[model samples]
Target: MAINRLLVLFLLIINCNLYFSQEVVIKDDKVLLDGKQILKAEKISLAQYSFFSVKDDEEVLLYKYMDNETPSYVNDDFFILNFLTEKIKVESTDLGKVSNFMNSKKAMEKIIKWLLKERVINRNGELNPDRIVIFKEKYDENITARTLR
Candidate 1:
């Protein structure tokens, strides 16, 4: 009986971790990595993505990725945008044809704008103050504002 109880507890822990490990998507504005919204500005800034625990008074560099060339095929659509600590990488099933789309500035801008808008990255470059509260509701205390700070 004790062994069975231990196994059940272990399973519960694993399930809980898996449930909370996935990215938390914001309902209204949608652009969130983990639980914070991405920042949209003329120049992409890393500070906006950094956790609040980071020292704001410290100087940091932000890097932006721009498509320098056009994609080669119409089917080359980006399907996922993943963010790391300091960099964001976009992935597409038709990666070989991505260059074709990248070549058309208008096409590239449209795609980028859609991603920004969908992800809730304010084009005007402001952080959504309610993000933490909203995230907590969806995730049920899995993440907290104090924890972020």
Candidate 2:
């Protein structure tokens, strides 16, 4: 009876760990967000409208579509750099153009510079890298918040 009870206990612990683990896996070139294999890009694009965990995923899209002010949290290091949202803007551009903009190093630098100039991100001249949760729509006012911790 004692041995049987110990085995049951061990199994229970293992099951609990598996239940709460947040590892996303990718197989066959498909990305699995929290064990749900994303078979199509449409699903991913739709899912981008909602706030989701940023673990094991290489890229994320944030959608902001409301006009109410919301709270957000940023890493202290990033906060000091002032990389928070004061305003957001979206443009009527194609996905290809948007993708190119995001991938362009020069564009990214310009964005960072603009953010620093506007006091939206760190301007202390020290790079305090932290994950930033950003809303996709511009001037929508609704802010979705997330934390790396």
Candidate 3:
């Protein structure tokens, strides 16, 4: 009877862990922010983002988003970075905060172009670091008060 109870408890733990899983993907060159792709940098150097863990002291990376932020913990994709290293490393610390600002649909449509400095595209899109300032200015122009914690 005790062994049966232990098995059930173990299964419950596995289910809970699966429930809170999350991910950050890096594809092509652009970081896929939210369901849509955003933020085109000249070349991503240190492409990494840090978030808080559900467990205390023990840092949970790779598969943890945050409290009340996982609209689809198991299947939602957001926030992409750039890098290709087989080794996986996780660390615990007060990384910082991730916030999303509301914007108009029109602004959203031109986001990629604005991020790429409104440059003419040919075979592949080019990035201009100088235009990033303009992008920030434009982004701040259409920000809303609402933000996720």
Candidate 4:
């Protein structure tokens, strides 16, 4: 019985670690998730909008969105920057020409610069303390809600 309990406890620990262990690294204008390239820099154009999609066979782990505040009547340009396992959605008309912003590397760099300017992350792509605090609060709220459920 003790051995079984130990094994279960070990498994639970490993599961928890896997759940929270997401390492986001930006290198050479490419986003690497756990050291694997996930962004393909390809565009999917539709009648209404065109945006880049994540690489095939990869899970989305991080996401961000931005807008240039262009009027609704005009065609808008946007970017999708995926860091690790999620999506980064950015749409801005003032971001310059559509063709240039459509490139995933440019979009990712633009968003990363914005993140740095906003102090959300340090120059090395690590989350700053303020961002960490926000994350902790969200985690606490999530845990509380789960317990209530």
Candidate 5:
């Protein structure tokens, strides 16, 4: 029994190391995954739907921002969504006023920070696929109703 437990623990550690071995590197207008250019960043204007697209070889990461109220110019609650899957919507109300992130560098930096904080992307710059599955199974649809418009 003890030997089985040790083997399990060892396997767990190896798995963790594998996951953490991946690295995400951000350069000017480029997102590098494990030293390869996987995405190119570009700024755009799409009203409330999106601010930019981080285009990878096979997928486009639409970076969206939703303001929940009339343009008060202050205290307007917002949500940042759609980096990977639409199932996850991050409330940015407590994070302060989110304006149009038009600068590619700044926008990508902020997006990466949020992704890291939310664990949507692992430290090695890989998407946490489990987040999508978990969110789809348990995410609240109504939480985004106010911002959908």
Candidate 6:
């Protein structure tokens, strides 16, 4: 039983290390690699997926795999749903804003606006308006919620 527990712990550490090694983080609406800016997120468009494509389930699965391998902007609950209905609307309330950045780019934009309203970032110009990737959320509690290094 002890050996099994140790094995599981080892596997967990190995999995975490894999993600820790290669990270793609969002900083000031720009994509960063190894703590350096790479792609300008806001300047980029959603119509043309410059990084990962989520056209089909297979592609989404690939994204999930890639997300597992790298530091993720997306959490386990991340999803993208497209539909039109009166009941389905962006939550305009400011009280609870967690998991707001999911489903669609439009939703992400709305979340960004909300974050801006909440003063999460000085301006949209200074933060990723769509996605923000960090290594681990719990590990970065004091983090300004903008630039994650």
Best by lDDT: 5
Candidate 5, position 147, lDDT? 46
By lDDT, the better pick of 2 and 6 is 6
Give the CA lDDT, 0 to 100, for residue 119 in model 5: 67
lDDT of each structure? 0.35, 0.32, 0.31, 0.42, 0.52, 0.33
> How many backbone clashes does every candidate have?
14, 8, 0, 13, 0, 4
- Segments of candidate 5 deviating more than 4 angstroms: 1-28, 32-38, 46-56, 83-87, 96-104, 123-125, 132-143, 146-149
Task: Rank candidates by lDDT, best first.
Answer: 5, 4, 1, 6, 2, 3
lDDT for 131 in candidate 4 is 56
By how many angstroms RMSD does model 6 differ from the true structure? Answer: 17.4
Predicted structure with the largest TM-score when compared to the true one: 5
Q: Is candidate 4 or candidate 5 better by TM-score?
A: 5
Question: What is candidate 2's lDDT per residue for 1-149, written digit by digit as tens?
Answer: 99999999999999998886444333443434455543211122311222122333322223322212233421221111122232233322222222223333322233334333333333222222332323233222222243322
Candidate 3 residues lying further than 4 Å off, grouped into runs, are 33-149
lDDT of 1 by residue, 1-149 (tens): 99999999999999998885534333332334455543322222321222111223221212122222334553422332333332333343433322334333333233334434343234432333344234223323221222323
- Which has the higher lDDT value, candidate number 1 or candidate number 6? 1
lDDT of 5 by residue, 1-149 (tens): 99999999999999998886545556765666567664565555533323223443433345555445666563564445554444454444443323435544455556555555556665444567677545334433435656445
At residue 140, what lDDT does model 1 achieve?
31
**What is the TM-score of candidate 2?**
0.23
| Per-model TM-score versus the true fold | 0.25, 0.23, 0.25, 0.30, 0.48, 0.25
For model 2, the superposed segments whose C-alpha errors exceed 4 Å read 27-30, 35-149
Better by lDDT, candidate 5 or 1:
5
Candidate 3: 10-residue stretch with minimal lDDT:
81-90
Find the 10 residues in a row with the least total lDDT in model 6.
57-66
